[model samples]
Target: MGWLWDNAVTLATIVMAAAAVAALVYAHLSITENRAAERRANANELWRERS
Candidate 1:
């Protein structure tokens, strides 16, 4: 734990990088899920229109 205090800057930089990566991954997954939901809604609308 003393090493962490001694290398606080380095540790913080690593933590920030990890957080950025996690954010990007979460954003990508959200976008993908939203697109899938949009597609299903569109398909349902089209079917209703035809029926």
Candidate 2:
């Protein structure tokens, strides 16, 4: 791992940045899915109540 030793700090920073971006993407997608589920649930309840 000569390359890693040569650029340890930069490599670590890059890895951390990638992890941060991934986490943000995951969180955004999870929130979107949760909101969609909530909407579906509400719609079902409304239809059930009407019938």
Candidate 3:
């Protein structure tokens, strides 16, 4: 476990990078879901106007 203590900085950097990637992915999914919901609402409004 002495090696782990010596490489703590490297391990922390990797963990930080993984967290950043996960945050980006979460943001992307949230944006996509919002866009899809907006499109559905728009389609419904258009259908109602046509009817």
- How many clashes in each candidate? 0, 0, 0
Each prediction's TM-score versus the true structure: 0.92, 0.94, 0.90
The lDDT of each candidate is: 0.98, 0.98, 1.00
Model 2: what TM-score? Answer: 0.94
lDDT (Cα, 0-100) at 36 in candidate 3: 100
Error of 2 at 28 (Å): 0.3
Model 1, runs deviating above 4 Å = none
Model 3 poorest 10 in a row by lDDT: 1-10
lDDT of 2 at 42: 100
Per lDDT, the best of the predicted structures is 3
Best-performing candidate as measured by TM-score: 2
Candidate 1 structure quality by residue, lDDT tens digits, 1-51: 899899999989999999999999999999999999999999999999999
List candidate 2 stretches off by more than 4 Å: none
